[model samples]
Target: MTIGKGLLFSLLISLVVQGCHSVVFKQSFDKQKWNDKEDWDYPQRNNVVDDLVKNHRLKGLNYKQLINLLGIPQGQSEDSAGIYYQIVMDFGNDIDPVYTKNLLIGFNKDSIVNSITINEWKKP
Candidate 1:
């Protein structure tokens, strides 16, 4: 094979390999700013949660294990069946945002995660 053709083939292979990998953007959480509506600017929080769940196996994780992995949740509530931890994400414009995403992790009586629910809302 000619040097030029070989180089082109190598470049094409590299591009294809790179395209196969999923790109995940890392997001940093601030406890103090978590509740601040003006400061809540994480558009990629859903992606972060998705990646964490995929990598950490959150389904069977216990309450303590979840806390250890994800730190304290933004808010939490208890019910007859289990406790719910709320992870919220806000994205879009300041005047009229696109949508808000909420990830609810439910822990059963044994304190082991049993359900993962994602809810999204769009502006009216």
Candidate 2:
């Protein structure tokens, strides 16, 4: 083969190999478990948030109970009448798109959970 032909063939082979490697890596990644709070280094943080959301019981919990169950919030705020706790999760494939979920819990004056809100979105 001519030198130019050989060089072109080699470049094509390299690109194909690299593309295949990326596909394999992405396929092996477990998106469901990525950055899962349950797997975080902090032992206190678990999947309690998932459980609470799944069971629809956040309103039944008090401030202390909620803290004990899910540890501290990523963000917190207080007002004259109530307090808010926010938990945020960002997880998805590392490729083109990603997803995020946020949980906002509101407590009444008595420190009992009064409302729970969840927001989710996708990013590219």
Candidate 3:
């Protein structure tokens, strides 16, 4: 190839490598955020039980309302009466990150939360 063409090809290759590196870096960061045990935000000692007991007012609360108060849930299950949301607040074990399951229970009927419970926040 001509000198000019070779230079252009080289530049293109460099750009491709740089792009790939950036994408890989971004993916690694996202994975770390998702899986890092340290990212779990456990409730403070004084407030832990209190926070769990302050259930969503069944008459006045809904799913979105609960989410607004508590943040996104880790998982959810549903049936005719309502949707049950499992809100994981934090990791129970630093060494075994998967051993803990923080549950923020939300019961929603037709998108409105009829009730909520902090059913379980324990290591399993």
lDDT of each: 0.62, 0.55, 0.47
Which candidate leads in TM-score? 1
What TM-score, computed on C-alpha atoms, does each candidate reach?
0.52, 0.43, 0.39
lDDT of 1 by residue, 4-114 (tens): 999999999999889867555454543333333335443345446665555557788898887776656656644444343344543455765566566678877788999
Give every collision pair in model 3.
62-113
Write the residue-wise lDDT of candidate 2 on 3-118 in tens digits.
Answer: 99999999999999989864412222121322334543322112344545665466868888877655566666444343433333344547533654556677787888887766
> What is the C-alpha lDDT profile of model 3 across 1-124, one tens digit per residue?
6999999999999999889864422121121233334334532322333434453244456667756655555565444454443324444446654433334454544666555544554555
lDDT head-to-head 1 vs 3, winner = 1
lDDT against true structure, model 3: 0.47
The 10-residue segment of model 3 with minimum total lDDT is 24-33
Global Cα RMSD, each model: 7.5, 9.9, 15.0
Off by over 4 Å in 2: 1-50, 77-99, 121-124
Q: Which whole-number lDDT from 0 to 100 does residue 72 have in model 2?
A: 66
Q: After aligning candidate 1 to the native by TM-score, how far in Å is the CA of 78 from where it should be?
A: 8.1
